[model samples]
Target: MTTRHDLQTRLERGIAALGLQLPAGAVERLLDYQALLARWNATYNLTAIRDPGEMVSRHLVDSLAILPYVQGATLADLGTGPGLPGIPIAIATPEREVLLVDSNGKKVRFLREAIRSLKLENVRAVQSRVEEVEGQFDCVTARAFASLADMLAWGGHLLTKSGIWLAMKGKHPEDELAGVPDGYEVRAIHELHVPDVGGERHLVVLGRTGC
Candidate 1:
């Protein structure tokens, strides 16, 4: 079992390594979110990741590794399964307004409960398909949810004219990059090295180069 102290220790190290400044008690709230997730997972099976310690690396650290790159004042995490990076991102950056979008009812409910439980004033959960969801955000993110083309097809409209699209990918998506839709261009590709996580991790950032 991943105790609170154990996760806190690991989380602190990760925050330091990543050069992230989490607000006071934000760590405890993140750990609170983790504990709540674990408790709910016992009955709902929210995620396949069972070990709490692993969640720290794969779910928490991996999700937060891109904090330095996240931009803008508003964000929409499309196809956000169990609020991978959305909830954590909101918790870490309370200044930004975060909308956690997911199609699964269970996950949506979980996100709602988490938001309420965490008392996150800047975050909200929306249950709907990404394309059908309303509102334009300054930034949009889809985490390992789908191919770059497909993700953009569904959620690109949510991004503002100058907004950025960030996608969490397992590796350098050469094929996906080749298939990027028109009007959007790949701006940057960051190779992520999540703490305690093996294997390749990359973050693909896209933006509109032309109208």
Candidate 2:
């Protein structure tokens, strides 16, 4: 059984390793969100990673690892299963307006509960498919949701002209690069080193052509 203190220690070390200075009390709120997810996950089966320690590393810190790449004031997380990255991002940066979209009702319900329990003022959860979601955002994030082409095809319209798309993927995704849609171009690919995570993590940054 992993204690909350143990989880906090791990999270603190991970954040320090990532070189992030999160807002005051952000760490505690992130843990609060994690605890909420764990409680709901036991009944709802929201995520496969069960152990609290692994949750601290793979879910919380793994999400925060991409914080430096995240830009703009508004962000939409498509196919945000159980609010991975989105919820943590929201907790870390309360000033950024975040929208977590997912087709799964249970996951969306859990997101709403997290927002309420965490007192997140700048977050919203919408139960909708990626293509049906409305509005434009300054940043769009998709975490291992779909291929590069398919993700842009569905959610490309949500990104503002100057906005960037942060696509999180495991491994390099070499095969998917050629499939990027016509208008969007791969701006950069960053190799992320998440503390305590055993697998390779990559963040593919995309933007409109000539932007």
Q: List pairs with backbone clashes in candidate 2.
A: none
Kindly report which residue stretches of model 2 are placed more than 4 angstroms away from their true locations once superposed: none
What's the lDDT for residue 207 in model 1?
90
Q: lDDT per residue, candidate 1, 179-206, as tens digits?
A: 8888899999999988888999999999
lDDT of 2: 0.95
Best by TM-score: 2
Cα lDDT for residue 199, candidate 2 = 84
TM-score of each: 0.97, 0.99
The residue pairs found clashing in candidate 1 are none
